[model samples]
Target: MTMASIAAPARTAAGELATFCGSLRWAELDEAVRQRTRELLLDLLGVTLGGSRVESSSAPRELAQGAGDGQATLIGTRQTSSADWAALANGTAAHALELDDVTTESSLHPGVAIIPAALGLAEELDASPAAMLEAIVAGYEVTMRVGNALNPASAYARGFHPTGVAGAFGAAMAAGRLLDLDDERLTHALGIAGTLASGSLEYLSNGAWTKRLNAGWAAHAGIVAARLAGAGFTGPSTVFEGRLGALHAYTDEPYVERLVEDLGRPLQVMRVSIKPYACCRYNHGLIDCMLSLRGSFGLDDVERIRLGVLSGGALLVADPIEQKRAPANVVDAQFSAPYASAVALVYGSGSLESYSTEKLADPRVRRLMSVTDCYRDASLDAVYPRQWPAAAEVVLRDGRRLSTRVEYALGEPENPVPLDALMSKFISLAGRDDAEALADRILHVDADPSVRALGTALRSGGGST
Candidate 1:
């Protein structure tokens, strides 16, 4: 399939987004959408709490604490700071563990950027849970729409991280909704957000900490953009379709019509996939297939393992086979399909613990990774971005071969992880004894008058306020 030529939209991208953000209300969402929104929010927050305990979080957490005190709450810690600072800290933490929810169509993590912006601003304004939910829904819609409009595979190939770039719009829309901005002001916010959106894919080349910080930076940029627009700052209205704008600068071809196509019939959040593994979303299907095959194949008896993946998916994690097999750190392992597959073979699982520093040196993991081969399959590539299909072939030392294919990962919309499973996953990551009760409160957050109560519950576990 080829990208279509960009055509003039009946309405400008910014104008359409402004109209949607200004008029959207949580009540307009169906019951399932509302409940899913709550689930995703809770999931992200749970992971954020878990992420705060990781070593990478120290810098961001310290930065937020140094920014001075305010109403915003940091997810894992008991600290408060200015809204933008809190977004930076909380967004960073949400993405640190690679456990955040993903919008498969756009290949972006909406909640990492949207939740921090919405929750931070909501706390500052003492916003109602209904209002917070509205911001999240609006944020997700705008982010995914813009993400789809940009030819995502081309963008990634051009060395752009979709989450960091698309996240700015998600953050801006959420903040704009919470600020109660009119269509005009919200349009300005989106325009400003488009210019501020930036993230490099260079981090994939190394186990650098930059990937963890991209979402936080986007969240911070969005809050500042929204605040500027609310203060009467004007930005170019045609930021998306402008000659020197995001689409022209970052993508090969822009599907401009997707920005507002089928505006609100099906809420995008309901289609998002909550990750079960602490690895890149691109590698999930292959990891699923590998884990399923683990029970039958012994590490010592396996000769070679092959993975057939979408060609575009290989660009991010599969190629550079040597680097993928010898990931320098946890961040590197999370994006490496080879490393992830090998871990699944040796350990029977690929949870967050599997990426620890000590695990990287496990001789068994390295031996298995060295023998794993990943290549593009025409069939898999054909259905990518819509269906993340993957196939696994295992060769035994005795010449016996076993193969299996998976079209959807466990957490994908087609085969969703149930709420009970989600809750247990959250508990495992959250590390709190009373997590179930806290989760109950968060799942029913729509009924709460303000987000302050939930914020208090999160902070009560640890950190300083």
Candidate 2:
């Protein structure tokens, strides 16, 4: 077949998305969608604070600190930097703990990439809080839509990190909106992002910190791409559906129509899940199952643990079974189903505290991990990318098998975390006495004239009530 015969309609997908991003207004958002956006922002901010001091964030934070001063606040710090640099530091920190908001169908952490880029540019431009929220909504919509189109399973099969690859486009849309780029320029921004979008699953090989860098780099590249677009730079308009476009290049299976399907009827922000656990989203359901079963049996009575994982996510959290059972660090533990199960069964919870160095060396946890076996279950994969169901079966020393299955993890929209619980989580992660007040400010940011005060309040070692 000729190129023309197989080529997608020129610019259709990118054009539609650019038009949506360029024209999306705060006034168009209903209170529910707006509230969801605010909640996601609060969650992102809390996670950023919680992860700012992590080893993975150290290099990026230092680079941002030394990149020269600008108007943007480096989140979780009493410092300022250029918009892109600030985005780099804040995005990396937001994802460091794996607690950022994630999507069901998209299978990517939208807020980590979108919120940091939007916040930094919004601060630099002195934009209204409403504008910032709108930019974030636009970013989430684009990111999730692109992720859905990429067929996350196929992307993972190719050893690509969907969060980093799809996140760049989302960040560009948010940044470009903040820069007041029109539809054409926003389209160019997406095209520019296409070249910059990248993330390798190779981080899984050795528990590398590069996985955390994916979010930061996506945010940085997005700001740079938008800035380049705003400076009259030109890029291909058919960046999504073209033969060599993102959808084709990133995955073997591309649901291209998903990009424009039901464009903003309900808004993608409403579909996001806040993570209660500090690990891969794939392990959350299994942890929930383990937590539910822990009280029913004594730890010493367990002979073996069998986990049901979705085929799509198996590569992420279950495969290389031996490696999953022996996590070397926090990053490894975060992606290991066996480790997640072991910790939840041993500690009866999967909080950030459960993934520490002490837990990594805990003999009880290691023993449980040794007995854990993760297998792909067709039942779990049947509704995956929509519902991340999981199951766990424990064999007792007396030959009794105790089994439990979870339809939705605690933080999923279907099994949503209560507002008070979310607040408690924010307080715990932010580690601040005034976290409640800061959360309130974040929730009602749309009423504020500018993001300056809100940005200041998000900084560490300062901005206390």
Candidate 3:
């Protein structure tokens, strides 16, 4: 009933953020939040393993060269490095495939960026199993809370990559937990990380794989920030709301109030959605809409496709369909909504093969992709940054047009992916593996204690990328 219970966050020591994060009582946490964190972790591992099978990575392998040999496990590549570099490589690998978790509101995938930081630190610090899980949950809360305070739509519009920008601070908080820093050092790590945070949306314009590496960079920077704080360094206290800081720099209209409010209640990570498809989360709804419409029209019947989505998201997926259509590279295929939708209709499924070179160049797939006409749907666009949706309509050459609307996308928090689906998703991405066993391993992450065995199995187990 006191102010501490109400404004308890305001009284927190700027430095003890890490300890506070580390001290989270797992038993007291809502079952949903705890379970969701495990789901995310499993998903991250799957994605990282999958990314390893992709074309040569300049950054992950590049970072490994500098690491030489220390004692950190690189996901796909045969390399060893310090905990921080290992975290960076693994984070990059995890996010490389665009198969990581996504927050609908923030439009950022926090786990890919935050988990590597925590995992690396956990391995180095020899932290208890329970402590590691608790830290991950705390990291998600911190990052999501920070992102929730800002205008995510505006940030995306201006071309700042939210995952890398906000992800750094979140990774720092999680790493701080592993390091056992008091509020002072923890807060310092955050403040320092805020300045170091950065990533742009330029990759959407040009097919570049660096954005995939941003998660690792953000996560690595976070661990570095924690180490800096541990070394007795100082950082600004008002990092989030500082006059010339993050919120102000990123947007003209900043909502700073959401950052500190309900700092520890409800848990933001629980609100995150795991990606069921490899393409951008913004386009997943349209993919679903198309998938639903597939039943109505066969490839022969389909004449043209009309794709509509929240205006803000249209640019990322449906816009510039020309180059985004028959993408020459892996990253491009992942960004093309039309391509993904076409793959769904042509193949009756949207999986790794949907974007393969053979598939991308397939005459039928290209023809289907060519007909995808995209425009902004006012109905869905009205929601803006609140809750996003995509609309689709497929017209057969026979003049029959089928339309479907998705109020909430499959992967969005509102219509979250079932835990079983997440596990199945992991296997799908981790390469054809025993999905049932993989899911069980993730479900019992704590019971097995050190995930070294599971990690080892997941790294080498999958058959396909």
Q: What would the TM-score be for candidate 1 when compared with the true structure?
A: 0.96
True-vs-predicted CA distance for residue 185, candidate 1, Å: 0.8
Residue 362's lDDT within candidate 2 is 97
Write one digit per residue (lDDT tens) for candidate 2, span 1-465: 432233233358887998877788888778888888888988999899898868788789889989988888887678888999999999999999988889889899999899999999999999999889999999999999999999999999998999999999999999999999888788888888999999999999888989889999999999999999888776667788889999999999999999998998778998999999999999999999988887888889989999999988989899899999999888999999999999998888889999899999999999999999988888888898889999999999999999999999989999998888788888888877788888888888877889876877776444321
lDDT of 3 by residue, 275-350 (tens): 7777788778877887887777568777888888666666677677687666776677788877888888888776
The residue-by-residue lDDT of candidate 1 on 327-377, one tens digit each, is 888888998888888888877787888888888889998888889888888
What Cα-based lDDT does every candidate model obtain?
A: 0.85, 0.89, 0.75
Worst lDDT run of 10 residues, candidate 1, spans 1-10
Off by over 4 Å in 2: 1-11, 463-465
Return the lDDT, model 1, position 361.
88
Better of 1 and 3 by TM-score: 1
TM-score of each: 0.96, 0.96, 0.90
RMSD of each: 4.4, 3.4, 4.5
